[model samples]
Each structure stands twice: as structure tokens, then as C-alpha cells.
Target: MSQDHDEALVRMVNQIAANLGPGREEADAAEGVCTHLEKFWARAMKRRIVACLDAPDGGLAPLARRGVERLAERQAD
Candidate 1:
């Protein structure tokens, strides 16, 4: 992905994490992010995020990473 696209992706994920982080357990927040993304984001968007998970500097927050992982695991099932 282009640098701009990568940054935008990171920013979007971070925003989701932040929105869901308040007054919730970390695990719950992560799951919430996963559900939100799964329900709202396009399938291609989810695939792009999953593909970026291993990038050395993908710029995903910890919660975002967890959310993406959950999304991937669910997709695998």
C-alpha cells in the first residue's frame, strides 16, 4: 500500500479503538472493534488490515492489532 493509504488505515483503526476503549475492559473493547469492523467495513478492507498486521511498522495500536487478529480468526472459521 502507499504510505498515505497505510497511514489512513492506521488512523481509522486507532479511532475505532479509542471510541470503544472508554469504560470497557481491554478485551471487550478489542472485540467490539472487531465486530464493528466486520459489520461495517468492506471485506477487502478487512483483508487489507489483516495483511498489514505483520508489517514492521504497520502503526496499529495494541487494541487494533487484537481486533484485527480476532477478525482474522473469525474469518478462518
Candidate 2:
């Protein structure tokens, strides 16, 4: 994906993490974000975001990173 697309995915991941993170434990919040991505995001979107996990400057928030990690694991399964 282009840099712009990757950046957009990073922003969206961060926003989703923020939206799902409040009033919950970190792990739970991450799980919520993961679930949202799995259920709502397109396969290509998920793949791109998961790829961001490996990017040196993906810019995903900590929670977003965790959620992406979870999503990656689920995807691999």
C-alpha cells in the first residue's frame, strides 16, 4: 500500500482503539478493537493494518498495536 493508505489505516486503528478503550482494561479494550476489525473491516484493510504492526513507523497507538497483534493471531489461526 501507499504511504497515504498506510497512514490512514494507522489513524483509523488509533481511533478505533480510542473508541473501544475507555471504561475497560487494556486487554479487554484491545480485544474489542480486534473484534471490530474482524467483523467490520474488509479483508484487505485487516491485512494492511496487520502489516503495519511490522512497520518501523506504523504510528499505531499502543492499544491499536495490541489489537492488531490479536487480529494477526486470529487471522493466522
Candidate 3:
């Protein structure tokens, strides 16, 4: 279960990086993609955290918190 969770996170991060594009630049498309990803990720993360609030799996609370922390950290960067 832990492995599955880790893999899911990796997949999401990989997809985000892939969408970031060829290189870091000031191009409109790249900027738009970055902004879109940030906004979408933030909203999704917020929703997920709320949904996970009462999850039965006790171990998931910390993991969810970590995920949200990581998401926020990435957004800050």
C-alpha cells in the first residue's frame, strides 16, 4: 500500500514536470502551463485534504499532510 501511494505521487509529479515543457523560458505557453498546473494542483490538493480528513486509515493522515506540505512547497518554488 505504501509503495502504491509513493508510485502515485511520483506519477503525478512526473506528469507535472512533463507538462512544464522543453525548457524554462518566458514563453507565454510555458508560463500559462505553469500557472495552470499550479492553480489546478492547489485546488485539487485542497479538495483531497478535505476529503481525507475523516479517512478510516489512520496512517493516511500524516501522508496526506506531507503531500499537502510538498504541494505547497512546490508552489512556493
The model with the greatest TM-score is 2
Worst 10 residues of 2 by lDDT: 51-60
Give the Å error, residue 27, model 1. Answer: 1.0
Question: Comparing 2 and 3 by TM-score, which wins?
Answer: 2
Strongest candidate by lDDT: 2
CA lDDT, every prediction? Answer: 0.89, 0.94, 0.45
User: Whose lDDT is higher: candidate 1's or candidate 2's?
Assistant: 2
Show model 3 residue runs off by greater than 4 Å. Answer: 26-38, 42-77
Ranking under lDDT, best-scoring first? 2, 1, 3
The lDDT of model 1 is 0.89
Ranking by TM-score: 2, 1, 3
Candidate 2 displacement at residue 55 in angstroms: 0.8
Native-to-model Cα distance after best TM-score fit, residue 36 in candidate 3, in Å: 5.2
Off by over 4 Å in 1: none
Please give each candidate's TM-score: 0.91, 0.96, 0.33
Q: How much is 2 displaced in model 3, in angstroms?
A: 2.9
State the lDDT of candidate 1 residue by residue for 1-77, as single tens digits: 67687678778988999899889999999999999999999887888888788799899999999998999899899
Could you tell me the lDDT of residue 53 within candidate 2?
87
Write down the TM-score for model 1: 0.91
